[model samples]
Target: MTTPGHLYLVPAPLDFGCAVQSPLTDALPDATLRAAAGITHWICENAKSARAYLKRIDAIHPLATTIQAQNIVELPREVHKKGDHHGGFDARPLLAAALQGHDVGLLSEAGMPAVADPGSSVVRAAHDLGLAVKPLVGPVSLLLALAASGLNGQNFAFVGYLPQDATERTDRIRALESIALRTGQTQLFIETPYRNAALLQALVASLQPNARLSVSWGLTLPDGRTRSADVKTWKRTPAGPDNQTPAVFAIGR
Candidate 1:
């Protein structure tokens, strides 16, 4: 019987969409880079973007081979929208290379795969198939934001994204705020880059004056900023454009 290959959960840098490229060595350890470079087969959120990331790493450490020689299987756009657990997604076929004793890597466009990112189905499938899953260390924007927020890090939850509708968004923010105040659990969520300012405004309007709100944008980038303040303070302060940079929003007492 062929020994099943291991699944490497490789992490990409948090500066994915930023204008400048972050140094790979600074963000990723050499072991993670080597592990990523060694794997040629990948289940990725976007094949083109994955190839580009691999090429960037290859420029520094040199991949086992060229990017063209790598085998990449992209997760469907629907998976990205509805998440990987939308049912009917059999990730076993994607791991066929692994069955043949060849290692496979799961990659996200930014940050770690399978965590608040499309590719959880693949990780679930790996567990079901008894494949050894190994996650390499790298930058995670959520943890970074939580640590920087100075909130209740001991008890926090990543609430994902908030509702888009005005009423629903306000309701959701208020609901999360209630939980934060009662349990001291830091509530974390994100918004589409273009909607950052709008969400910030809504947050300021919905949360109580004393409730603290933290907004982190362009994490791991040179101009990245993480600011935490009470809702009242935020309302008085002039709001700056996030410019569609990826951001994390957190609320706590």
Candidate 2:
């Protein structure tokens, strides 16, 4: 019987597409970098970004295979738009390399793969296929934001992105706030860098006056900052995350 290779969940730095990037060594453990360096096959969100990330890794750890020789497969674009967490996407095909006894890396553009990211299907498929799944130590923005928020980290939920439509977004924020207020569960979500300020406005306008709001941006970068305050305080200071950087938003009592 052939031994199947393990699937390594390789996390990329949080600085993807940001104005400033943090050193990988600063955010990722040596073991993770070494493990990622040894994998020659990958199933990634975007092949181009994956290559770019690999190039960065090569600078420090020296990839086992040259960038051109790496067998990199991108997850379908549809999976990027409509998430793969619901099990609708079949990811076993992507794991052919691993089935053949070649270790494979699963990467997202930023943070951990499958957490607030699109690679859950691949990880789920690995488990179903009897492949060992290993998640490496790395920075996960949601957890970082939650830890810094001073909110109820004991019980929190990452609700992904909020609705884009004005009324719907406000309504959604209110619903999330209701749960946070009533149960002390921290509500976490994110917004595209460009829509960040707008979402902050909607969040401020919708959450109860006493509800705590935490906005974390530029995480892991030199300019990284997390601001937490009640809705009233946030309203008093209307400035929020600028439109150029990734941000994580959280609300709770």
RMSD of each: 1.3, 0.8
| C-alpha-based local distance difference test score of model 2 | 0.93
Clashing pairs in 1: none
Model 1: residues with Cα > 4 Å off, grouped in runs: 85-88
Worst 10 residues of 2 by lDDT: 200-209
**Candidate 2 runs further than 4 Å off:** none
Give the least accurate 10-residue stretch of model 1, judged by summed lDDT. 235-244
lDDT of 2 by residue, 95-147 (tens): 99999999999999999999999999999999999999999999999999999
Q: Pairing residues by index, what is the TM-score of model 1? A: 0.96
- Tell me each candidate's TM-score: 0.96, 0.98
Q: Candidate 1 overall Cα lDDT vs. reference?
A: 0.89
Q: List clashing residue pairs in candidate 2.
A: none
Q: lDDT score, residue 187, model 1? A: 98
How far out, in Å, is residue 235 in model 2? Answer: 0.9
**Candidate 2 total steric clashes:** 0
